[model samples]
Target: MTDKQISDIKNRIAVIAAWIVACLFFFPIFWMVLTSFKTELQAISVPPKLFFKPTLENFALIQERTDYTKFAWNSIVTSVGGTGLALIIAIPAAYAMAFNSGRWTKDILMWMLSTKMLPAVGVLMPIYLLSQKFGLLDTKGVLVIIYALINLPIIMLILFNYFREIPKEILEASRMDGTSTFNEITQIVMPLAWGGIASTALLSIVLCWNEAFWSINLTASDAGTLPALVASFSSPEGLFWAKLSAVSTLACAPIVVFGWLCQKQLVQGLTFGAVK
Candidate 1:
C-alpha cells in the first residue's frame, strides 16, 4: 500500500478503537438508563432484554414511595452550599500559599492532601459522635459543613495552582495603584482566576453530591440527600432492580447534565497550566 493510504487506514483504526473503548465505559450508564424504563421482570430477565417497551411506572413508583423532590433539594443545597463555602475559604488560603510561601507551606499543603488518603471509615466514628454531641446529625447545615471540610484539600490545591499561574506583576501593579490587599484579591486575582474557581466549584459540587457513605450514615430521613435516598432502596425483601435503576437515574440526572454543560470549562480549567 502507498504510505498515504496506510496512514489513512491506521487513523481509521485508531478512531474505531477509541469509539469501542468509549462504548465499553459508557455501557453501564446506558444499561442503568435503559433499565429504568423497564418492569422489574424485564430488568432481571435472563440475557437482559435490551429492547422492551419503555414505561414510566418505575419512576412513578419511586415518587409514590419517597419524596424525590425533598431529597433532590437537599442534594442541591448541601452540594452548592458546601462548594461555595469551600471556595470562599480555599481562595484566600490558596492565594496566601501560592504567593507568599513560607518554609512550611508545602508541608502544610501536603498534610492537608494526605487527609484525603485516609479511609473515611477510620474517622467515621469520631465524626458521627461529634455530630451527635452537637445535635447536628440529620441536619443540612452539618452535611454542608462536612462536605466543605472533606473537599477543602483538593479545592485548595487546585486554587493554589491557578493562583500561582496568575502573574505576580499584576498584583504588584494593583498595589502600586493604591489598591488594598482585599481589593487586589477581589478585583484582580479573582477576575483573572474565575475560570479555575468555577471549575473547582463544579468539581466540589459533584463530589458532595456523589458522597454516599457520609450521607447514608450521617442522615436518616430529614436531611438525607440523593445518595442516601439511593441506598434506602435496599430492603430485606430484595432489590427492586427496576425501581432502583429509576431512583439512581433520577439522582444522577442533574449532575450528569451539569457536567455535560460545563465540559468546556472543565477541560479548560484542568488544562489551565499545560500550554504555558
Candidate 2:
C-alpha cells in the first residue's frame, strides 16, 4: 500500500477510538436518563433493561413532592451571580498580573492556584461557622460570594493568560494616545480577550451549577440549588432509584443544553490564545 493509504487507515482507527472513548464517558449519563423513565423493578433488573417501556411516572412523582422550579431558579441565579461577581474582580487582577511584573507575582499566582488542591473538607468547618456567625447561611448572596471566591484563582489564571497573549505594542500605542489604565482595559484588553472572558464565564457558571457539596452544606431551602435538590431525594428508607434518576436528569439538562449551544464559543475561547 502507498503511504497515503496507510495514513488514511490510521486516521480511521483514531476516529473509531475517539468514538469509543466518548461513548464510555457518556454511557452513565445515558443510563441515568434511561432509568429515569423505567419502573423501579425495570430500573434495577439484573440484565439492566436497555429496551423497556418508558414511563413518565418518576417525573410526575418528583413534581408532586419537590419544588423543582425553586431549585432550578436557585441554580440559574447563583451560577450567573457568582460568575458575574468573579469576572468583576478577576479582570483587574488578571490584567495587573499580566502587565505588571513583580518579584512575588509568580509566587502569588502559584499560591492562589495551590489553594484549589486543598481538600474542601479541610476548610468546610471554618467556612460554615463563619457563614453561620454572620447570619449569611442559606442565603443566595453568601453562596454567590463563596462561589466567586472559590473560583477566583481559576478565573484570574485564564484571563491573565489571555491578556498575556495580546501584543504589548498595542497597549503602548493606546498609552501614546493618552489612554488611561481603565480605558486601556475596557477598550483594548477586554475587546481582545472577549473570547477568553466568555469561555471563562461559561466554565465558572457550570462549576457553580454542579457544586453539590457547598450547596448541601451551606443552603437549606430558600437558596438551595439543583444539586441540593438531587440530594434531597435520599431518605432513611433508602434511595428511590427512578425518582432520583428523574431529578438528576432534570438538574443536569439545563447546563448540558447551555454547554451544547455555546460549544462554538467555548471552543473558540479555549483555542483563542493558544495559537499565539
Candidate 3:
C-alpha cells in the first residue's frame, strides 16, 4: 500500500478512538438524565430499563420538596463571585511571574500547585473551625472565598502561560511611552490576553460551580447551593434514586447549556497560545 493510504487509515483509527472515548465519558450523564424520568422501582430494577414511560413527577416533586430557585441563585452568586475574586488576584500574580522573573518564581508556582495535592479533608477541620470562630459559617461570602482559594493556583497557572506567549516588545514600547503599571495591565496586557483571561475565568467558574464538598459542609439552607440540595436527597429511610437523578439533571443543565453557548470562546481561549 502507498504511504498516503497508511496515513489515511491511521487518521480514521484515531477518529474512531476519539469517538469511543467521548461516548464513554458521556454515558454516565446520559444514564442520569434517562433515570430521572423513571419511577423509583424502574430506576433500581434488576436490569436497568432503557425504554420506560417517562414522567415529570420527579422534577415536580423536587420543586415542591425544596426551593430550587433559592439554591440555584446561591450557586450563581458564589460561582461568579469566586471567579471574579480569583481573576482579580491571579492577574497581577501571573503578570509578575511571567514578566518579572526571580530565582524562586518557579518554586513558588510549584508550591502553590502542591497545596492542591493535599486531600481537602485533611484541612477540613481547621477551615471549619476558623469559619466558626469568625462567625462566617453557612454564608455565601465564606463559600466564595473558599472557592476562590481552591481554584486560584489553576487560574494563575493558565494566565501565566497565556501571558508568557505574548511578545515582550509590545509591553516594552508601552513602558517606554510612560504607561503606568495599572494602565499597562488594564489597557495593554488585558486586551492582548483577553482570550486567555476569558477562558481562565470560565474554567474557574465551572470549578467553583461544581464544588460540592465545601458547599455541602459549610452552608445550610440560607446559603446552600445546588450541590447541597443534591446532597439533601439522602435520608435515613433510603436514597430516592429517581428524585436524586432529577435534581442532578437540573443542577447540571444550566452549566451544560452555558458551556455549549460559549464553546467557541472557550476553545479559542484554551488554544490561544498553542500555535505560536
Candidate 4:
C-alpha cells in the first residue's frame, strides 16, 4: 500500500479503538442512570430489561427518606475547603522543593508519596481515636483537614513537576526587581502556573467529593456527605438496587456536571507544559 493509504488506515484503527474504550468506560455510568429510573423489580429483572417504563418514584423516595440537601452541602464544603487548603499548603511546599532543593529534598518527596501506599484502613483506627479525643468527630472541619492531608502529597507532586518546568530566569528576574516572596508567587509564578494549579485543585476536589471511607466511619447524620448518603441505602436485608441507583445518581450528578463544565480547564491545565 502507498504510505499515505497506510497512515489513513492506522488513523482509522486508532479512532475506532478510542471510541470502544470510551464506550466501555461510560457503559456502567449509563446503566446506573438507567437503573435509577427503573422500579425495584425492573432494576433486577431477568435479562436486565433495556426497555421498561421509567418513573421518578425512586428519586422521590430518596428525597422523602432523608435530607439530600444537607448531604450535598456537606460535600460541597468539604471538597472545596479541602482542595483549597491542600493547594495553599502544596503551592509553597512544591515551590520550595522545586527551586530551593536540598540534599534530602528527593527523599522527602519520596517519603510523602510513600504515605499514599499505606492503606487508609491501616491508619483509620488512630485517626478515628484522634478525632474522638479532640471532639472533632462528625464535623466538617475534621473532614476538610483529613482530606487536605490525604491529598497533600499528590497535590505537591503535581505542582512540583509543573513548577520545575517554569523558567527559573523569570523568578530570578522577579527577585532582581525587588519582589517579595509572596509577590513572587502571587504576581509571577502563580499567573504562569495557573493552569497546573487549577487542574490539581480540580482533581483534589473530586477525590474529596467522592471520599466515602472517612465520611462513612467518621460522620453520622450531622455531617454525612453525599457518598455517605449513597452508603446509607444499604441494609442487612439486601441492597435495594433501584433506590440505591437513584441515590447514587444524585450523589454523582454534581461532580459529573462540575467536571463537564471544567473539562476545558482540566485539559488545558493537564497539558500546560506538554508542548513547550
Candidate 5:
C-alpha cells in the first residue's frame, strides 16, 4: 500500500479507538438511566435484565416522596448566583492582570492557582464553624458566596489566559485615543474578547451546578440542592437502587441538558489558546 493509504488506515484505527473509549465512559450514565425505569428487584438482580419492561413507579415514588421543585430551585439559585458573582469579580481582576504587568504578577497568579490544590476537607471544620457563627448555614446566600469563592481562581485564570491573547497594540491605540479604563474594557476589550468571557462563564456555571461537596455538607432541609435530594434516598431500610437511580437521573437531567446545549462553546473555550 502507498504511504497515503497507510496513513488513512491509522486514522481509521484512531477513530475506532476513540469511539470505544467514548462508549466505555458513557456506559455508566446509560445504565443509571436504564435502571431508573426498572423495578427494584430488576435493578439489583444478579443477572441484569437488559430488555425488561420499563416502569415509571420509581419516578412516581420519587415525586411523591420529595419536593423536587424546591431542590431544583435551590440548585438554580446557587449555581447561577455564584457564577454571576464570580464573573463580576474575575473580569476586573483578569483585565488588570492581562493589561498591566508587575514584578509579582506571575507569583500572585501561581499562588492563586495553588489554593485549588489544598484539600477541601482540611478547611471544612473551620468553614463549618464560621458558617454557624455567622448564622449562614442552610442559607442560599452562603452557598452562593462559597461557590463563587471556590471557583474564583479558575475563572480568573481562564479569563486571564484569553485576555493575554489580545494584541497589546490594540490597547495602546485605545490609550492613545484617550479611552478611559472602563471604556476600554467595556467597549473595546469586552467586545473583542466576548467569546472567551462567555465560555468562561458557562464553564463556571457548570462547575457550580455540579458542586456536590459544599452543597451536601453546608445545606440542610431549607437550602438543600438536588445533590442533597439524591442523598436523601439512602435510609436505614437499605439502598433502594431503583428509587436512587430515578432520583439521580432527575438530578442530572438539567445539567446534562445545559451542558449539551453549550457543548460547542465549551469546546471552543477549551481550545481557545491552542491554535494561532
Candidate 6:
C-alpha cells in the first residue's frame, strides 16, 4: 500500500479500537438501564432477555417506596455546596502556592496529596465522633464540610498547576498597576484561569455526588443522598435486582448528564500543561 493509504488504514483501526473500548466501558450502564425496565423475573433470567417488554413499574415502585425528590435535592445541595466551599478555599490557596514560593510549600502540597492515600475508614470513627460531639451528624452542613475537605487537596493541586501556567509577568504587571491580591485574583487570575477553575469545580462536584461511604455513614433519613436512597433497596429478604437497578439508574442519571456536558472542559483542564 502507498504510505498515505497505510496511514489512513491505521487511523481507521485506531478509531475502531477507541469505539470498542468506549462500548465496553458503557456496557454496564446500558445493561443497568435495560434491566431497570424489566420485571424481576425478566431481569434475572438466564441468558439475559434483551428483547423483553419494558415497563415503568420499577420506577413507579421506587417512587412509592422512597422520596426520590428529597434524596435528589440532598445530593444537589451537598454536592454543589461542597464544591463551592472547596473552590472558595482552593482558589486563594492555589494562587498563593503557585505565585508565592515558600520553603515548606512543596512539602505542604505533598502532605496534602498524601492524605488522600490514607483510607477514609481509618479516620471515620474520629470524624464521626467529632461530628456527634458537635451536633453535626446527619446535617447537610457536615457533609458539605467533609466533602470540601476531602476534595480540597485535589482541587488545590489542579488549580495550582493551572495558575502556574499563567505568565508570572502578567501578575507582576498587575501589581505594577496598583492592583491588590484580591483584585488580581478576582479580576485578572480568575478570568484567565476560568477554564481550569470550571473543570476543577466539575470534578469536585462529581466526586461529591458519588461519595457513598460518608453519605451513608454520616447521615440518616433526614440528610441522605441518592446513594443512601439506593442503599435502601437492601433488605433481609434479599436484593430486589430490578428495583435496585431502577434506583441506581435514577441516582446516576443527573451526574452522568452533568459529566457528559462538561467532559470537554474536564479533558482540557486535565491536559492543560501536557501540550505546553
Top-TM-score candidate index = 1
Cα lDDT tens digits for candidate 1, 1-276:
999999999999999999999999999999999999999999899998989899999899888889898999999999999999888898889999989989998899889989989899999999999999999999999899989999999888788878988999988887788998788789889999888888888878888999998999999889999999988877732378899899999999999999899987666445533333
Residue pairs clashing, model 1:
none
TM-score of each: 0.92, 0.86, 0.84, 0.86, 0.87, 0.89
Candidate 3 deviates by what RMSD?
Answer: 3.3
Model 4 spans > 4 angstroms off: 1-21, 236-238, 260-276
lDDT of each: 0.88, 0.87, 0.87, 0.88, 0.86, 0.89
Candidate 6 lDDT at 267 equals 74
How many pairs collide in each candidate, listed in order? 0, 0, 0, 0, 0, 0
Model 4 residue 159 distance off true place after TM-score fit, in angstroms: 0.9
Query: What would the TM-score be for candidate 2 when compared with the true structure?
Result: 0.86
Which is better, 1 or 2, measured by lDDT? 1
Which lDDT tens digits does candidate 6 get at residues 1-276?
A: 999999999999999999999999999999999999999999889999999889999899888878788899999999999999989999999999999969988799889978888888999999999999999999899999999999998888888888988999999998998999899999999999988899888888888999999999999988999988877777742367888889899999999998889987777555533333
Worst 10 residues of 3 by lDDT: 267-276
Q: In model 3, what is the error at residue 169, expressed in angstroms?
A: 1.3
Residue 129 lDDT, candidate 6, scale 0-100: 99
TM-score of 3: 0.84
| lDDT accuracy of residue 113 in candidate 2 | 80
Candidate with the larger TM-score of 1 and 3: 1
Model 1 global lDDT (CA atoms, 0 to 1) = 0.88
Candidate 4 global CA lDDT score? 0.88
Candidate 2 Cα outliers beyond 4 Å, as residue runs = 1-17, 45-47, 236-238, 263-276
Q: CA lDDT of 132 in candidate 5?
A: 98
